[model samples]
Target chain A: LDATAVADAEARQAGLVKPAGALGVLESLSIQLAGIARTCPPAVPGAPAVAVFAGDHGVLAQGVTPWPKDITAVMVEVFRNGGAAINVLSRACGASVTVVDIAVDGDVAEGVGTGAEVLSRKVRRGTADLAKGAAMTRDEALAGLAVGIEIANRLVDGGADLLLTGDMGIGNTTPSAALIAAFTGTDADLVTGRGTGIDDETLNRKTEIVAAAVARTAGVDDAINLLAEVGGLEHAGIAGLVLGGAARGVPVLLDGVIAGSAALVAQRLAPASIDYCIAGHRSVESGHIVALQQLGLRPLVDLDLRLGEGTGAALSVPLVQAAARVLNEMATLESVMAGPDA
Target chain B: LDATAVADAEARQAGLVKPAGALGVLESLSIQLAGIARTCPPAVPGAPAVAVFAGDHGVLAQGVTPWPKDITAVMVEVFRNGGAAINVLSRACGASVTVVDIAVDGDVAEGVGTGAEVLSRKVRRGTADLAKGAAMTRDEALAGLAVGIEIANRLVDGGADLLLTGDMGIGNTTPSAALIAAFTGTDADLVTGRGTGIDDETLNRKTEIVAAAVARTAGVDDAINLLAEVGGLEHAGIAGLVLGGAARGVPVLLDGVIAGSAALVAQRLAPASIDYCIAGHRSVESGHIVALQQLGLRPLVDLDLRLGEGTGAALSVPLVQAAARVLNEMATLESVMAGPDA
Candidate 1:
């Protein structure tokens, strides 16, 4: 991001028709966008694309959530068929959806479906149970990250100015909680929550699982090793998307806990990658708050959304556009004073 | 609102692919839309229109804000010329802007400008200084409300499913703080804030002015009389928009402190009016919080927005549409199970 452009945008926001600081976060957001674009007023982000990284969580065997592990593959199909929440929300926000099969347990064909594009980029079918052992080898985690980075590069090269991270992995929040707790050094109990409406017994067990996983990875400061030890493949992929988007200077809108945990990984890999990231919404998942706090990202929307198929991030597309539009389309106070139509 | 439809929408929400209640406020918002439309799945709110009621406050003579009194008229022109924050945001959200000159002290023509439609509905040049006397006569307040109701009806009749409340009145927050303090029984210091921008001395004086005005209307239970005593014409007009949108079963998205205070008046006039009101954003103004609390409304966006030209409301159009689209477009879990493309 260009500091000169940021300064220019701040000056521009000051002179806009509204009172100084009246637009609040939006004023700062526009400046950030400008800085990212290396311009006085950032161009309105065009062709937003949400990449839903689908994988299967090995931790589901521990009963972290009641949902079946097969539900993950079913959701990838659901996403590809335009039958999911992210599809509906992306349509509403005029964004495209791309479903990437990173490591789902079930078979998913690679091609553009009737709804969203489906990419077969699976590094593995599934990971080893994180509660018992490493979720994946470091190489597998790096492979997942490479897939995400490739997808993000493809989307950006194909004219996507904004990238949104979406994830579909059953019981993935278990690993998300573990990842957030490990990264933030927060108590596992505080970072874990009921995923997909789990019972109290399951939630407690999930907390224990998260605590044990974080404790196992306590001395591992390497982001990839930590991700491989406890994070799901989708988390690795989503982190790669964040890093890829940041490398390309495209803003990545992060969804719920899955994306938040992934963002923490991305931030550890490259501290400045957090600069190009936007927290789309505060998820109901408790760990999401910790992850966002650690990343220093304030969500653009807070609808108590816990759904992680990028629906929350898709909903914020218009807001991100409006932030840039205000900078580009709105007349300065001096211009307004010059003439009504100025 | 239809109770049966609300129940049906809730059931439908549960059947969606995502976890139950994962969508959070969006789930309730969709159910509310269903109730408003009297259907299980409400049609996506289409053709959102913002009615920016422009007025002048006699309380500008009270040294409440640093902006010139003529800023009200200048902003109205800015809105009409599509150079205002509201216009830029509305355009981004696929909404239309309509500037209504309900009580501008300066002359404003009635016609469709190159940007927004300017409606000539001025009831009077301006209001009397609320610090000294009634802001308007009872009949004038009623007339201002009539203008608002008429505009809402016209927009809804023209196929607008959503009506957004906007206001352009220099020093309007002085009266807004007074109105909120009156209705919510909050302290003047608690409700009062820097409208555009004010120093310590002006803020203290503004708080005193609000305290004095609310004291004058301490026992006034009549909503209309209360509006006449302390509310600006734009407030009355915006209240009318709320009432009219409610009466017609169209959702009304409300902007900053001015719209918040107006919605309070609308609620007092007809408590049911709040059922159709959606707080667009929590304004930076302290009084907006008090007013939203009194109305029992949760804001969709809280970007610290205080520029009330329907900019905040307009920014929520995509979110509102997404809420409804999820209900209408998302395939039920059972349907997804029926087939991959179901």
Candidate 2:
């Protein structure tokens, strides 16, 4: 019924063990689930699906990464070809990866019959450069969020008990940092990091640009307005996924900085939205740690992982599953005839 | 066929659409097969099993962890009752955990019915303190190695394609660090880390103790002598699992410092043993980095994780699966007709 309820349910399932508190944090998570679902033995099923939203940023034209903007489409091809990191990881996790062509430069045929299903929901070819104007209009931001919600709902209806959120958009971190700074009221410098391995000069420039974007949207208090001001379509989509996951009572694994920014925005939209969110890993990015701490969620993994292709979330899937498994399977001390005194 | 050939064939069958070289290291792995029997579409079945080897050290009488030596048996009961981190994580990975009561104060019932199967292969109920004399006899070391190999071979025969190596012996890290320092030719101070959150004073004492053990084992060149000089039976078993994995063609995921130390011993016995090993994570332990680098294996995750219950390897399982899956599932550019030119 509530977040605390879901957490309690998760703990009860975990506590039915032969040794009390033996499963550690895993048992704690079972309680977390109980609080959120307001039931014991929260029925988490198989058939989890991961939605990876890909887009392009007008800021990329400013030379954020060494690779060209066209590499985005090439990587879309890579994902379709099952050669990308996320593709390989998803297959290992036994979770299907669905790619959303939210803002590719050109019109790609819908459902071109790739390795995984491809969702063509282009809000625009690319976002407008935040340096020149708002990244997207309010209408566009809302549309992207709707697209994410639609995709998440479809996957759930199709029997995906879990939803993992990943993003594949270059230069999107600039907008992500800007949005995080706006929502958390942190200084842009503290929140932004050298994304995609930028040079010192570019890193400094990126930080300044993000700060300016945050300043521009200083008057906007609502998360949706902040998103419309500086957020990429992928960010909006991720925020929508978080909301959708909370609505469906499915845990959403947030990948990296981009996803963290989106989660912050989603929390602002719905205070209870944090219930469904699980921080996958603490990215090397400065903003990510701040964002995660602010959301009061600890990352399962903390590799100097800068890759934002849902790789972190994929790696953490087993850990989360372990948490659930301990809740469901471990035997209690009474059943084993092991006394508490013993 | 040899291990390399087997690994290569398995990689090829996983089926990446490109020329295979495009994925670099992952392609090479798909080619090698990691000891799986069949190369054609190397089917890595899901019934994962983790062997947690528990032992007691005479050094516990010298005071290492704040917990007493009796707690080792208590924890074993915790493991049996499914209250440990391994239980939670293993369940999360859909893996069955088996606890090997290799060393303890008293006789554990043969095939003691815990939620997990307990294999009592105790070597004199624990090793003598290395500070006093050799930790274990050379004959005992060999027998332990044999037991590890036997179990690994049996698991493979029983349809387990992947083997996760975990250890659970109190004050075992002291022996593990000593063994690592002896083999890696590193100073004990560099290799010995504050295991299990010891105080700074305890850490210094641990360093000195490990250094002394390394000094005693300096002349020993072979695994048998090394094990006799300063190795835990659990460590010896893990080394055998690494070699057995290569010999049997099942991938062995190394957990933490203990497993890393065991790997070093295995390499001494057979240099080609590195073929079947995958470093699961770069744990918080300082020795882990040295061992991983010496082995020339990159960890899939780097979470500063020091929990040595196969939690690191369990987390990396999805990534390993992903690497193989990308080879198998991703559509080739030719199939998609997307054109090789971006």
Expressed as tens digits, the lDDT of each residue in A187-269 for candidate 2 is 98998887766778888888888888888987789777788888899999999999998888888888989999999888888
In order of appearance, the predictions have TM-scores of 0.98, 0.79
Candidate 1 C-alpha lDDT tens digits along B1-342: 899999999999999988899899999999999999999899998899999999998988888888888988888777877888888888887788899998899999888875799999999998999999899999999999999999999999988999999888888999899999998999999999987789999999999998998999977999999999999999989999999999999999998899999999999889988999889998889989889988999999999887788888988888898899989999898987788444
For model 1, the chain A TM-score is: 0.98
Q: Write the per-residue lDDT of candidate 1 for residues A137-205, one digit (tens) a residue.
A: 999999999999999999998999999999888888898999999899999999999878898999999
In model 1, chain B matches the true chain B with a TM-score of: 0.98
lDDT of 2 at A47: 64
Q: What share of the reference contacts is kept in model 2?
A: 0.29
Off by over 4 Å in 1: A340-342, B340-342
List TM-score (chain A only) for every prediction: 0.98, 0.93
- Compared with the true structure, model 2 gives a TM-score of 0.79
Error (Å) of candidate 2 at residue B299 is 4.1
TM-score for chain B of each model, two decimals: 0.98, 0.89
The digit string of per-residue lDDT tens for model 2 on B1-342 reads 355656665445444333223234444555544344345445654766788787888877666666566656766776776766677666666677777777776656556444467888776688888877788899888878887887788778877778999888778888888887888899999999877778888888888888887887766787788887888888978887888877886888888889988999888898887777888777778988888878887776665556676777776676566556655555544544456553
lDDT against the true structure, each candidate: 0.90, 0.75
